[model samples]
Target: MPSIQKPLTKRAWVRLPSGRRLNLLDPTPFDFEADDLALGAARTVRWGGHSVWEWPLSVAQHSLTVLAIGEAEAPRPLTAAQKLAFLLHDASECLGVCFDPISPLKPFLGEGYRQLDQALQTAVHRRFGLPADLPPAWKKPIKTADKRAAAAEAIFVAGWSLAECREALGIRAAPLSADPLTPIYGGLPWEPWPARIAAERFGAALAGLAGSMP
Candidate 1:
């Protein structure tokens, strides 16, 4: 069970596996169950050049790829714990509504969303059996992978012509490479891959780490 302080009414509300039913209009909050909220959030968060039909690059997909990149990009091997951290880094957005850099809701979200975002992040890490905090070195590279995925998405999945993406999004067209098993823009409604493919890829990377242990 996890909770966030409802800013408008000043009460605590439990966010269940499903992401629904908060104390938006109530004074005293109650618990609600809605796991699909995270999945919906994953689909809703859009970057520039959005399309209802085109399979946009999802946070879930980016997260999975980041984990793959982390394993490949690590100077030596990465611990299981490190790999898990990369996989779950954006899990917070699963709780709060995902917003793009230019989305208007971002500024309007204010303090309440920020607090809820932090709470969900911590909860997701704990749920995955990862430490609540991530290492400083892992932070920059994971973010680089995130951006790299975004760059790829902007060019490939989001239907932005390379020149249009470069001029509008300021994202350069970079070479795309990753673990062979990791899916690249596998399918639309991208959240499914996390519970499906990402879990396996993460496990394989961790196994590799263990084998390299001295």
Candidate 2:
């Protein structure tokens, strides 16, 4: 067998634990690995790491929060694909420096950022058998769930008050008073996990979801 050719040093690629290189500028469905996404998301800090707890909140934890809120409030159970979509919503951000830029900063960065994000999202969708354009039925629940999760994180994890999350953060919904994951994980509600635990849990979750897909 021939040896695999290495990517050029100048390309926008990051090496993963699986010994694969994901090219950010031109990512493909085949490039995503569960563990890579998990570890990357676990290291990515939300809200600039301004946390009340000793450890900062990771995107992996936030994704689970979004999933929990989405699932719990729905009239019926969300399908595995739908849940996976929620979990991987920000998977694109896991590609590089593990930095999750605040939503407010996107406007200043302009179109290129959005284009790249969309490209990666399309790849993620295809990799997991989701439609490139997600279902319209997903609109309301995901929007509401995502907002509530952000508000809860702001108040409980990031040292913000409900008033601040509303007036300043522009999150109109009332923050969740209780930890959504408490019944399942049994930790201090809304407290951030260490990166290693977050990564392992996220990896396992992704595997379970993928395995459940028909």
Candidate 3:
């Protein structure tokens, strides 16, 4: 089967030791390029889990959530730039996952996806003028919030039983309707959430982060 083609500039491709390639655009060359790449990539997908119509959450929305959580949990004050970095954290996934979660191909996810994702992340950070390596101190909090989001998602969106989730996560499940899961991608019928809605959710989460700051 022929794969879908994405438009790319030659400068975007950088060679790796393993002979793999990456997209590492020069940050200063384009204005708002990071945002543009992220926003554009969010519109499509490579692989996503089974849900209503085999749908999955979009990277754009997820990045927004991460930003919200970062703002809410970051111990030290973050500049506007840092906040943007947080929101666009998963920008690489905007293109597609290095590997997607699914049966028959699940094993590829462990090391293959990890290396690719890390490279993409490094490239994105360098492109956006952020540090190449994530600071160690911030790691745990970000990961914790990510897991909490996962837990919340399993109960609300994936149709997991509360008892099953409780046994897995060791926490009582709460009412899911209050924080109803919004589908990032549309179904085969193609009923997607509005881009404005995605932006709004992102903005609100970013605001919440500010509120959580000391």
lDDT of each: 0.54, 0.85, 0.50
Q: Give lDDT for model 2.
A: 0.85
TM-score for candidate 1, please give it: 0.61
- Our tally of clashes for model 1 stands at 4
Supply candidate 2's per-residue lDDT for 29. Answer: 89
- Which portions of model 2 show Cα errors greater than 4 Å? 1-10
Worst 10 residues of 3 by lDDT: 183-192
Q: If scored against the real structure, what TM-score would every candidate get?
A: 0.61, 0.92, 0.57
| Candidate numbers, best lDDT first, in rank order | 2, 1, 3
Candidate 2 displacement at residue 144 in angstroms: 1.1
Best by TM-score: 2
lDDT of 1 by residue, 1-214 (tens): 7898765655454444454544322311122222333353345344642543434445555666667666776888877677767766676564434444443456687887666666666665555555566668778877877666666655555667778867877776363543322354454432334333433443444345334433
Candidate 2 shows a clash count of: 0
Tens-place lDDT per residue, model 2, 1-214, is 9999987663588788788888888889898687888999999999898899999999999988888888889898889998888888888888654668899997877898888888887887898888887888886688788888888888888998778887898888878888888887888888899999999888888889988898
lDDT of 3 by residue, 1-214 (tens): 9999998654556443234444544323222233344443455332254334334555555565555556666788777656756765565554323233432355656885666666666666665556677676655666655555555555555556678777854545242332323343333222224445554555455455434543
Clashes of each: 4, 0, 2
Question: With candidate 1 superimposed using the best TM-score fit, by how many Å does residue 121's alpha carbon deviate from the native?
Answer: 0.9
Sequence-dependent TM-score of model 2: 0.92
